[model samples]
Target: MSCTTAHAHELYQLYASHLIKRDIWDVKRSVMEQRFQFDPFAPQISCAGIHEHHKILDDLGDEMVVINQAYTRLWPAAQRDCTYLTSRRRVDDTDIYAVINYSVNHPDDHIPASFVRASAEVGMVCESVIRPQCTETSLDALTRQDIQTKIYYQAKISPGGWVPAAVVRETSKREYPKFLHQLGKGCTEHFSDRPLDCSTVKKAFESRPPPAE
Candidate 1:
């Protein structure tokens, strides 16, 4: 089969073993096309190492490992911190409720505000899968703004969730790195069959363990 983007093909080759084993190739394929296509000169931005296509694959493998580890599961369950923001989107009540429920059940074991923000964005895109009307393109300017606010708040409220305010502010701006913009596009294209990858790597944002005194 033809590849969606160079990055997607590279990712398939890189993690073909694990992806096929998990039966996650289908989801990864779309993620590749929409989010992983590499761009050398496309603005240099990195959100938990997902700024480029190759890194996205790295994150997926790492995240899967982290998810399976018992130690990693000790983190508290996710919270309803963004309710204030999600409440505004009356049209997206179903998704909002779903997100709230998921957050409560699955606490983020890993603690990197950037990655948390990234995850929230990914969750929103996933929600769009079920609620197509809420796709990024379909959203009006105001609703989109609300989502940004929600993303930032979600990250802010999480334990040890203190990412730079600039990063939060940047989410609302129009001039993001090319890869992010494309990811946003992918989030909206809901039915596109392009090879995509959405799994993220925890090591990318892994805080270093304290050095021996």
Candidate 2:
């Protein structure tokens, strides 16, 4: 997990752009096409309280049609297409985001004979809270910088051909942490409103001790 001063909405926008915007895929050197079938926040819903916001999110669901092409060392280059159900919800002070493949098919979507059909599930939660700081003098007042958002992310993906589960597991173990570090650096840059030295951030995250098993 990582902490940032960015608000939940800012982080949500970042995540949404990465998934929905075509330019982001281009930056990653992947071919992607996305069409939105449904959008819960299309008109941008507004609510007065936290409970109302949560209820609106639960009631309205978003759906998208996607086609992606990529190459990986563990598998041959292939294209996959699928429809996904995407959602964002607020629970108390925490914001949750999720995307899962839907069984429904879009008439316009077709996979080539050489391509592999794949599916994935992703979820992330961000909690906003005041983090206490250690100081020489005993004080209770919290500074603006003390307010932080904590993020947790999880993803389950299948390449859908004959790829071994062991290979997938090992790949995730090596790649997921790197993804998190990049995300942390992104959040820090957004929060600070300035670009940070990549080497400094890399060293900081890499030097941290591993999580307890």
Candidate 3:
């Protein structure tokens, strides 16, 4: 398939947000901090260019905003844990981004830093999976092409490939933002702001008892 500049730009905007929330930056720091014996970097599934290319994607109208918000909501589906940080990297020319979930309870795990680094490399591919379907139900109507065009890249990042800009060609803030804006009773919008921020997004969620409750 062929990609266009518009779609590329939108993807870039969305990806910029993805890296932050996904802890890609933090993951990199963890590797560098540990030094050798604790070899830096995490293992990945593929060396797809998309992982690094996230910072750049088509600027397909306002589609980027929708995908960005979509990613944030679905992050927990695959992430599952709040304490661990994640990072992705390209494996040479292949289209893969090995995912690493760094152990956050370093003090409690009482494991050596080198061990932790080693463990992250092993956990890279297996633990990461499809975007949480339940969370991304709003995109239920998305076509296969749509999946590949918009969500596929970040959902399961890999390299040696590219998504054409035409995929999200029809998307726009006017059309897609409403989906994100409508979720959780607009809680993400906050009391004073026009859009969602870190503080208000999770405010509307109600804690629940377990199965026995």
Candidate 4:
């Protein structure tokens, strides 16, 4: 997706916000409810050493662990815990932003007997590149309209229970692009006027204690 009125960093922040604020930003159609088993943005650590290696020591970014109750029209409601990593980087004249989420079993997470356990692995990347047509000499003069964003998304999911893996994969192939489109739309609307305030999230990760050895 390309934005005419948002820069790369601005777009990146908005994208990251949707993931970090999952309880607020997740699509209701996909996730019925979400709760953080381990909030990467919380001020206090929930687990002593669970996420020690998931830290953002460089520009790779923050990580999170969450439990979500999700559903689809073809399958019953299912529950899963996932680990997510979100990051941003600059290569040459382009800015690359990415999010990776995969199913993980946490010792602290307990699944209800009524809920089927599901598994998913998803990867999304957005690249914001400066338009070649732009010839602005001053950095301050560069406008948001000068950047174009390209998005790539991939997912593999098994809804568990009676859902076939092939059916799930086929459904994802058809649906994930729509999901990305919605994400881009949300990002554009969210930062229509100003960029997101990411300091709070950044601080939380920065201040977190190292994972236990």
Candidate 5:
């Protein structure tokens, strides 16, 4: 049989098992071509193909594992205390929320305010099976005017009761490196038949751990 668009959906396994499992979302993935042949898990980015493409995981048991793994790798980290300033919701009932933290360029200089904007877009996420109401979420708009930093919406996701997940920095003993390492391993040994998106890894922000004591 011809291997052209003729294979089962199989991912790189390494990306989700390590590196990108957690950092995938924040990372800015390049425009990935749809994996139509030889792989079933590839997404349909075009308007017409979107609805049908998103339904890749509807009833298939094998594909469900792929979506679940994607979900875990995509969740943001917990809030921190010492460096953390505050956390609040942007809107009611919606999965969108914002977390603010204090940081500085140098010790002498006062820490500038940093905020993380998060939301599950609702209709944009690609699935083996399409959900009724869904939109992809992504880093829609990131604005920085002098000191102001605003990250608008991007791709959407299912609102799986997603809330503001947080952990205070100073209070939290775990360091950034430690967290990054763990974050990379979002799915552990859970394997999937999905190709790895290099764009996703390239676009991720640099993870910085706190200074050594």
Candidate 6:
């Protein structure tokens, strides 16, 4: 299942539109603003490598697009929420991200602590299960030669972490201007273009229904 760059962007746009129609951005933005307490329009915001409010929304939208697009290219038998957001870091250099949570599909399947990191980041996202070493049996040790060979093989075929760069560029060209317009309009009307504290947003959402799938 190989997905072309064009198809991936199209899939992203479709899901992204669904999310916007449902006011997903508003829901997230309300909470995010409250938590971060940063002004989106401040020049200092850009200097910190943090995207302003609109860009954050676009990134989330972009991530959804990538996940769904990647799904179309995955083996049909592969069944799991491909979308994950990292949440915690453990002492062993293994980080934990949401295995699945807070989505309409697969409701009640909020399994955490499933995904584990084996080593440092590779340029691509790939997973393979390794059996735990047992005290009773000594495992054969391999040096740099063996590890290098494995890395070469895996990286050669991996998708290089996300959708192709060309797809991202094209998607932005088509979608970003409209997104920016909407964000500006929305902020002006609702927030007066100010960033809010997360506590307010969190309480507000506490009463509303959970975000859509």
- Per-residue CA lDDT of model 5 for 82-198, tens digit only, reads 111111223333323342212212232221233222222211111111122223222222111101112232222212222222222121233324433442344332423444332
lDDT of 4 by residue, 15-49 (tens): 44433323211211223223212111111101111
In candidate 5, position 192 carries an lDDT of: 32
RMSD in angstroms, all models?
A: 21.1, 15.4, 20.7, 15.8, 24.1, 24.3
Q: What TM-score, to 2 decimals, does candidate 4 have?
A: 0.51
* Alpha carbon RMSD to native, model 1: 21.1
For model 4 the local lDDT of residue 148 reads 56
Local distance difference test values of all predictions, in order = 0.24, 0.37, 0.26, 0.42, 0.23, 0.24
lDDT of 6: 0.24
Model 3: lowest-lDDT 10 consecutive positions = 147-156
**TM-score, structure 1 vs. true:** 0.22
Supply the global lDDT for candidate 1: 0.24
Best by lDDT: 4
The digit string of per-residue lDDT tens for model 1 on 1-213 reads 222334343423332222221211001111123343222222122222111111221122211211111111113422212101111121332232112211221343443342232221112222322122323322222132223211211111221232333443343233333334454454435324543222121121122232244
Report the lDDT tens digits of candidate 3 across residue range 1-213.
Answer: 133455544333332432332322112212223332211322122111222212221122322211111112222122111223334443443333343433233332232222112222223321112222313322233222221111221121211112222222223213233332232223222222432222211211112122231
What are the per-model numbers of colliding residue pairs? 13, 0, 35, 2, 50, 4
The top-ranked prediction according to TM-score is 4
TM-score of each: 0.22, 0.47, 0.19, 0.51, 0.18, 0.21
In candidate 6, stretches whose alpha carbon ends up further than 4 angstroms from where it belongs are 1-19, 22-162, 191-213
lDDT score for residue 58 of model 3: 18
Find the 10 residues in a row with the least total lDDT in model 4.
39-48
Which scores better on lDDT, 1 or 2?
2
What is the Cα-based TM-score of model 2? 0.47
Candidate 5 to truth, TM? 0.18
What's the distance in Å from true for residue 149, model 1?
A: 22
Candidate 5's C-alpha runs over 4 A off are 1-12, 18-159, 162-176, 182-213
Per-residue error (Å), model 5, residue 133: 54
